[model samples]
Target: MKKNISLAILAIVLLVLPLLFQSRYTQHILNMILIYVMLGISVNLIFGYIGALTLGQAAFFGIGAYTAAIISTKLGLSFLPCVLCSAVMGCLAGFIIGIPTLRLKGPYFAIATIGLNNIICIIFLNWEHLTGGAVGISGIPYASILGLQFDTERKVYFLLLVSVFLIFLLYRNMISSHYGKVMIAVRDNELAASAMGIDTAKVKVIVLAISTTIAAIAGAYYAHITNYVAPDAFPVMESITFLIIIVLGGAGFKYGPIYGAVVVVILNEYLQYFEQFNMLIYGVLIMILLLFLPSGIAGIVEIAKAKYYEKKKIYYLKEVGIDEMK
Candidate 1:
């Protein structure tokens, strides 16, 4: 009940946030943060839960962006159809990549993903007729559902917020289901899971596909919201940034992506002022976090909760004279 109340309060706050901050730039940043949160959730599924490190998510992201851009601009499809097509393309890419690369373990898998990212970026760069090459696709129409058009940052913010919430719900449900337990088993010990009759390979591929689909959806949102799709936007560096969000927020934790997205987006926004030092400072901060906070910000909250419950249990035992007996 308390949890529900808290969630309700949070929702109310988020809904009113735009009204409080009337700056278009600020709202735009908020929308970007939401998009990154979705991206972080995607990474969290494959890396955090499935224990497969991936650096090629941006490829799927780009695929989705381009899919949306091409279809919407060339074919004149609506927002929903564009997003749907983008998701299908992203999932297809995921399966193609996951089947070949998921056979490798540890750093090999990570390296394969990096190669995949590079390959996809090259395709985006060279495919002039399709992807617009270096120039990129611009003037994407605003996203619309029914007759309602998301033409303003404030409108886009609500649309994204709703989408993120729905995705979060689906993610939560998936993690709580039997398949979620299977994913954990695979993550903990793929060999053991395989010995126990679990198709570890299949699980990894499924997770990867789901993750890529989410990433692509986010990309679609980005394309529409920004009114442009560029090859440069989905670089290898952007993939790393997505990984950093989940790593810093708390991989495997429910709210990790949300917390991490807010922090990373805000930090990046401020760090832009540093220009040449931006990446340098970002690297140092990540190193510091990895060294000290290892599990990220979510881990800190988890520890606090554990300690609180432990103390409460001790107090209860003392009250019941159990402590005296011990």
Candidate 2:
């Protein structure tokens, strides 16, 4: 209960902190960052926890964005239903993809996903009737809940933060459950995990379905938040960004996505300010992170543990030498 309270307080702080800055554009960017935080963490559910080397996450993201846009614009569906539909679509897609391809090992899955992303992107670009093609969709209404519309940036911030909290709870519950243990075990050794009676393939499918659903939710919120959806918004590069967020945040760590989101978002804003050299900067940062922080921020924490214990060992040996009695 105390731990829950602490998390609640921390969440409140994060949600309220941005209001101190009064710029609308800044608020908007920050809200997008928060969106990515959920997306990033959700991806970690697949990539980090379940050990899937997926690269087509943005395809699901695009699916959700398009679903929400089409539903809201064409069918006049409410925001929550549209968003939920997007998640359902994502889960279906994940299940279909995972059933066959998840049986493949490592790099093959990653390579296949590259092709998948390209295929999705091209379809989105050419499917003018459904997706509005390359021209994209517009006039999406802002998100609403229980008759309360989030019309202002600050209100949206609170709304998204609540989502972030709720999803965090979902993550915590899953990660602490038997299913999460199976995921971690699979991450360590799929063969051994299967030997232990864990259905590795089924687990992978379930995890992928969950992760993709979460990503779709993020995408739905993003479409509503931006009131626009373009093919460019769901590029293969965004998938890479998601991977890096989990990697640089310390792949398997609980807080990895949040820390990674802060970095990616900050860099995006800074580089976007420069326009022409922005992608180059993103590439450079990714390289640096890959080279230096390969294990990510979570890795740093683990590394520090050894050094801390080494220092403690020396201090304790000197202070109370067992050999002195001998």
Candidate 3:
């Protein structure tokens, strides 16, 4: 009930924020935050829930973006169809990669993802006819619903707001189900989960598919909003950023992605001035955060809550003693 109330309040805040901040730059940043939140959510599903360190998540993201771009530009399809196609492409890629690769464990799996990332990048770079090579595909159409085009940043935010909310609910539902428990069990000890009659391989593959699909959907929105798609836009750095978003926000916790995305996006904007030292400073900050709050911001919140409750309990005991004496 409390969580629901908080979410409702948050929804209201997001809806009213545009009225307060009319700056185009700020609206653009807000839109990016929403998209990155979706990306963070996708990453958390696999890495946080199932402990699958997939470093090539951006490949799926790119696949979705390119898919939407191709369909919209070539076939002149509507936003809905393009988005759906992008999702399907993402799922197909995930299935193809997750099949043989999911069998690998630990660092081996991580290494495979790196290789996957490189392979996908190469394809995007070299597939000039289809993906427009390094020059990228441009002039993509804006998204629309019932003839209403999301052409401006503010308009795009409304669409993204709905997308993020629906996706977040679905994510919450998935993580709260029996499947979620099994994924946690697998994350803790795959061998033990397998011994307990869980099909660990199937669970991993299914979760990967779901994660990739979510990333693709976010990518579709990005492509529509940006009106372009390029290989350079979806690189290893983007995947790293996705992982960092979850880490900073507290992966495995609800609302962690939202916190992480907001911080990272705003910090990134400000840090761009330090250009050369940006990454170094960013690394230092992350190191400090890990050292102090190893579980990220969400962990800190949990710790604070625990402390608050402990103090309240002690205060209640003292009050009870005073009443007995009276």
* Best by the lDDT measure: 1
**Decreasing lDDT order of the candidates:** 1, 3, 2
For each candidate in turn, the TM-score is: 0.97, 0.91, 0.94
Put down candidate 1 lDDT per residue, 87-146, tens digits, no spaces.
Answer: 999999899989988999999998998988999999999999988999999989999999
Give the per-residue lDDT of model 2 (tens digit) for 1-326.
99899989986788677878799988887898889898887789999998988888999898888889999999988889998999999889889888998988998999888888899899989989989988999999988888999888989999898888899889989998988898999999999999999989999999999998998889899889889999998888889889988998888788889888988888788888889999887888889889888888877877798789877777777788643421
Q: Which structure among the candidates has the greatest TM-score?
A: 1
- lDDT for each candidate structure: 0.93, 0.88, 0.91
- For residues 153-265, could you state the per-residue lDDT of candidate 3 as single tens digits? 89999999999999999999999999889999999999999999999999999999999999999989999999999899888888888988888899888778888999999
- lDDT of model 3, residue 118: 82
- Could you tell me how far off, in angstroms, the CA of residue 306 lies in candidate 2 after the best superposition? 7.6
Q: Regarding lDDT, does 1 or 2 come out ahead?
A: 1
What is candidate 3's local distance difference test score?
A: 0.91
Please report the TM-score between candidate 2 and the true structure. 0.91
Poorly placed runs, candidate 3 (over 4 Å)? 1-5, 314-326
RMSD values, in order shown: 1.3, 3.0, 2.5
What is the TM-score of candidate 1? 0.97
